[model samples]
Target: MTTMNKLNQVILSATLALAASGASAQMRIEISGVGSNQIPVAVAGFADENIAPQQISAIIKADLERSGAFKLIDAGVITSMSNIDYGTWKAKGADALVVGTVAKSAAGDYEVRYKLFDTVKQSELSQLNVSRAPQFTRLTAHNIADDVYLKLTGIRGAFSTRIAYVKEYDKRHYELLVADADGDGEQMALRSNEPIISPSWSPDGTKVAYVSFEQKKPVVYVQNLITRARTVIANEKGSNSSPVWAQTGNKLAVSLSKDGHTQIYTVNADGGNLKRVSNSAGIDSEANFAPDGSIYFMSDRSGGPQIYRMNGDGGEAKRVTFTGNYNISPRVSADGKTLAYISRRDGNYQLYVMDLASGQEQRLSDSTDDQYPSFAPNGKYIMYATQAGGRKSLAVVSVDGRVKQRLTTQAGNIKEPTWGPFMQ
Candidate 1:
């Protein structure tokens, strides 16, 4: 199938362990090629009698700053709109200003009201009222950041989304982790002594499908995030790997070798309704669903491992890659207009993106061993795993190959990152 380190040879059994909440080591982001046209904005601390204004404003500022899209102005002197000096902010090169207030409600909850103002036009662009439980303080801040981002950029923000990945703790210990988009709020969703790989998030972001070798063979399992319970979906006669969720979240496209040759199959999320999807004699695996519901996968049907596209029911299979001899791990964007994949060029595996409309391909990563490209829900960035300094870590890059940042962990190697869908 789509070439992966065979872990079935190793045999070890271990139970899952719960790690502390949040990232063990917050990911340090490095920015590059941040465009000069960055929108300068000022975020004022929310006025509240009890809540710490800096605590809420920091999250919003960090979210905007890390995106490489906006530059934050010094708003330490401005706390609420009642004292906002729009002329001074505009003179300080701010295009927009965000001011807000947080107040405790009679029901013991918190209500946050924020306004986005266009400094140039001297008019308010948008206002938001968010009511949230006290325990969801961080989440409430992220929600405000999302709203501010959408109001200014006109595109949905993925700050509220989570990411799934595999964390290695020595040779025999591994854990599947789910973390915030900024690499914080990490939680151990699944743990095993055997190897774990290919953690895929369901479209609804409530479950994760992954391949585990705990039973001495590569088996696919879908685990519920809330209950921490799992259902063995593809533990048939042979190896099962590369489980990818369909857009509907009710089905998954996986690669199985039960019939002696690796091929793609679709199975219900609840472990029933098994149906073969690809009939190619050659190996077909790593199937990902496009926005339009078509399946794009990797196969060697043309004598080399290349990307292929086919219908959801496994008919009319067609080749999608021509320039490279080795191109695998095809991930279509949320919009289905762009395809991101890994290509082996000059003996180096790197990330590349293809514009399906113009039949154009552009290399997006410079790392030699970059793999497992997952597109952000907004389709503006792609996150993938790469080896650096002899350690595997996750990195994110803009679709255009600029604005790159790396996320590393202090625990161990990080791999197989899958960006979760937009929050419901």
Candidate 2:
């Protein structure tokens, strides 16, 4: 279910406090399907990679394969970029090839170099040389993958970005986890015996704002990722949840029930200057910002939950969704050309994407229970929460709905995934 539902059904009744702890479960990606047109690429092993802390070639392969945009062909020990193996790769059904080298300096720094080749065209597409400490081996690989993906697809890649989500170990234990975009390298930002929901990343990616049931009421808190410090941003008399950052990163639009009904309110990031944005008597929550600074949210003013759009500072609202009687969790694409949300049909909640200009909508998920649709930073894919085999898990699908994959942790159920911004 969406955060708005949780706020009404469970926020007032749950009771617990948050504690800091280290995250334990490692998430694994399982590709359930692939796109009809996939670029077959072979990523060769990097020379002298043993000196690094992580395998650069394997990480790149996993990143690309997980995207469902590339078909991985085994390179089989080829590591040198100097050799002209274009004909060999082309005959082996690889349209493109990647090769690189890794060197460790005496002072413990590392130099990572990689080159992308077009086997059919028999030419080098791009190359880069990066220097970083040993701890950034995986990140270096992700950067290389991003470059390769962008060069081939003409769209920027989101491999180097991060993601935030909620993990529920049990009814008594809950955690807010930050991890890589691929769902690995997780760190627990906040842990509680109660519930935590609506994890939203700031535009600059330095902090996160979320609702915590720490004091037995849903209160909004902002936590710095670098220092692990948290501050209460909203703690009104009633429920305070569904905190989403504005594009400028200086303000947050949150759902508050202080007015007797949940409504959208814009508050300063430091918890000052609270101002109401929506004046509707009906329930209004799940506020999302579009690229142009307009706010898209869910409101039941029309007798059923539907998405509505209003200006940034509480103007007249115009309904954007009319096809479904139930629609919530309105997430806008980075370009503002598409909107991804959950719509109920045939007694099942599924992920749906709509073209803002044409009003054409398409169903993107085959599962019965899907929620929390988060777009990749590149806007080519969406990562959402869904139920698989009765276990809550994360799923990613291409914006075209041609590709799909399921991401599951080793131990617990994961939900409310918010994909972070691209690294500056």
Candidate 3:
């Protein structure tokens, strides 16, 4: 069996944590494949960027390219908007254009401005201007990329969002890291000699609830990103694992083996008001919340593990997935219309997305050992972890399976990626 199979078989097991440590280097991305129909766009180098701390246009270009939504046409430092030849760009096969300027203000801040143009129509589409400290140059570039993405695709860009995953150096060394969507700007949230898994972000993107093995057993904890303070949410006897935040952010759904068999339960964020939600005799773990207050999870009550759903208060339990004999890790999209999960097919575990209303499903990944699927805030993509050649890394695939990207680190193995919501 593959590592994913082993992990899923013990999905309800307890998992890691030590004291916080310094941040690590960013994860390097190797994006491959592209959408069948990509928008052709051009981003020119920002004027006066030589004095800035970071190159704004280059960052924007990389962000857009990694998204697999745009085909970047090199503009080669055409920094002046007045010099943009729409006709020339159109003839060069660029349907859209982006040009910008960066300058240091007298008050010691960076002023950034960018404009989007429709080369086909020879008209300006939209523009934005912002001022930020030198340290936020990369963030400013990401914001501009988000604006451009929203303007062109009608979908909110997740470039400004964050993701959390566990990096495993060995059985005795692990770290929970939070980083930007592109995998840069990494900050260590927790580190330990034991293992950590199931890092879930709060709806507001302020706190993360994860299962740690600090006490030599599985326990759940919530950590504040700002102050680095944390509170134990669940350390009940037996295994405590897989904590997912509710939409309100005050409660979480977790799987605990404190009872006879591993089952699902809802607990207050403070680790109070623990309420059992799943009454299955078989293992009922990996509970995830839908937007409508329904809980979707995995259970083996029917003789095999399959996806099931119940009301928020654990009423009227019903099975949701039938085609697959083994389905774990059900991740509902923000809109509650789609579900992403891992399924075993022909002895290989792959990522799959299902339409809640239509009962139709499509496989999204081509890898053999994919696990822990997490949806982007926009629901346009799903990020998951897959292992190949004995090495584990993170991968993202468009909902339609047209685009794919691979993210790897300089050292260690990364897994259990949880994409964060749009920051407030």
What would the TM-scores of all predictions be? 0.91, 0.93, 0.93
| Predictions in order: lDDT | 0.82, 0.87, 0.86
Pairs that collide in candidate 2 are: none
For model 1, the stretches where C-alpha displacement exceeds 4 angstroms are: 1-23, 48-54, 104-108
Query: What TM-score, to 2 decimals, does candidate 3 have?
Result: 0.93
Give a tens-digit lDDT track for model 3, residues 254-296.
9999977999999999999999988977999999999999999
Show model 3 residue runs off by greater than 4 Å.
1-20, 82-84
Report the Cα lDDT for candidate 1. Answer: 0.82
lDDT of 3 at 27: 80
Please list the Cα RMSD from the true structure of every candidate, rounded to 1 decimal place. 7.1, 7.1, 7.3
Q: Is candidate 1 or candidate 3 better by TM-score?
A: 3
